[model samples]
Every structure is written in C-alpha cells, then in structure tokens.
Target: MAKEIERKFLVSGQRWRTFADEGIAIRQAYIVAQDDRSLRVRIYGNGQARITLKVGHTALVRDEYEFEIDRDEAEDMLRHAIGNVIRKVRYKVPHEGHIWEVDVYEGVHRGLVIAEVELASIHDEPELPNWVGREVTGESQYSNQSMALGISEGARLHQLA
Candidate 1:
C-alpha cells in the first residue's frame, strides 16, 4: 500500500524552476466518479495506465494500491471520458528530502500551473518554497485529472501550448 500525502500550489512565477533538476512530459486522463476520497484510476501517457484504489483508511493512515495496466486497456476503459485530454509540461523539482512534480498547464488549462509532492509516509514534513500559491490538497476541482475532464464539460478553452 502506498500513501501519498503532499501539498499542491498554483505556480505564481518561474521560481519553481530554481529547484527543478529534470522532468517528463505526460498525457493524463482522470475518470469521473461520484466519490472523490476513493480514486478509481489515473491514466498517464499514451500507453501506461495505473489503477488506484482506496482499500482502507484511518485517522492518520491512508492506504491505496496502484496496479500497472497496458495503455490500450486504460484507453478503452476511459474512452467515454467527458473532458479533453490536454497536453502540458511537467517538471520535477527536488526539495527537502522529497521530489516535487510541478505541472505547468498548457492549452486551455494554461495560465494555470501547479506543483505536487509525493510523500513516503503520511507524517513526513515538507518544506515549502516561496513561489507556492494557494494550497489545494483536498480540492478535487484543482486536481489534474479533473482539469482534464473540464475541457469537454464546457466550451473549449484555448491557451498557447
């Protein structure tokens, strides 16, 4: 079981680049579900897919399982997704004792940027950088998966990729 607990922020400037060592460009799709506390699946890239499920929970512990799946299977599963699959630039930054993945939203979600850090344990402490904006950890709407779905849910929003 892997528990991911970290903070997310809206990118205000290029300050995050200072800590960036490397990054990978990924295409992701988030499936729509009625419950948020329980995430169904997160599809990353064109041929890679991971299904995440919340099997148990406690006051201080969050447990989840991520299984690797073929890209074609994930695409077929999410073929009916409501939103658009957007293209964005994601950069990896290192800070404290953890690595942070910062996503610079392009296309419609442009002008929007965010950073996420995955923790080995739920009790781990994370150091914050100066460029971090609003914290949106529990906000589902701010989730990258939700943002991808937002594209088709409404009119097409354009941003320079």
Candidate 2:
C-alpha cells in the first residue's frame, strides 16, 4: 500500500518562480468524486498518463494507488470523468531537501496557485518557503477532487478537452 503524506499551502507570492524549473502541463479528471475515495486520470504534456486511486477520509494522508496507462486510454477515461477536468502547469521546486510541486491552474481556475510537498512520514516537518501563504491541509474546499467537481461555488472548471 502506498501512503501519501503531504501538506498543501496557498502561494503567497511569486518568489517561488526563482527556484522553479520548467513546468509540465497536466490535465486531470475524476472518475469518482466521493468523499472517502476517488479515481483520477491525468495526462501530461509529455504524453505520459496515469490513473490514480486514492482512499482516505482526511486530506493530510491517503492510501494512493497509481498506474501508468496509455495516453489514449487516459483520454478516453477523461471523457467519461465526472464533472470538470482540471488543467494546470506543475512546476517542481527543490527546497530544503524536499521537492515541492507548485500547481498553477489555467482556464477557469486561472487565479489559483497551490503548492504541495510530500513528506516521508506524517510527522515529517518540511521547511515552509517564504512564498507559501496559509496552510490548507485538511481543508476540503481546497482539495483537487472538490475543485474538479466544482463543489465550490464560482469556480468555472471545464471537462475533458
């Protein structure tokens, strides 16, 4: 079982750009958007694709199962996905022995920027960057599943492209 322990934060400023490497464009959609479990398909700009299954009740930790799939299959899954698919550019930034994934949303979610850092353990304390604003861990409203489903009011997300 693969356990994902990570923390999420809102980006406060553009300072993260200084340490960011070239970003990869990502498109993801949810097959199941339930509160306790979800399945998602993600396609990357590099033609890579993956389907992920996550099960958990909390935002901080989850049992994640991911499998690489053919791009065609992933695209097909996206078409059948529930609600809107999410499009974002993911930038990798190495800071203080941890790699942070900063996601810059595009399309209807253009103004949102969120950063996440995975930890070795749930107790692991990652160094917070100066550009990180409020910690949004365990916040359901900020979750990717919620965002993709447009569960929050006023966020215009799109379906499979």
Q: List residue ranges in candidate 2 displaced over 4 A.
A: 154-161
Report lDDT (Cα) of residue 67, candidate 2: 97
Measured on C-alpha atoms, candidate 1 has an lDDT of: 0.62
Question: Considering every candidate listed, which one attains the maximal lDDT?
Answer: 2
lDDT (Cα, tens digit) per residue for candidate 1, span 14-34: 877877866655555555533
| Residue 146 C-alpha lDDT in model 2 | 83
Give lDDT tens digits, candidate 2, residues 34-112. 8799999999999999999999998889999999999999998988999899999999999999999999998767878
In candidate 1, where is summed lDDT lowest over 10 consecutive residues? 152-161
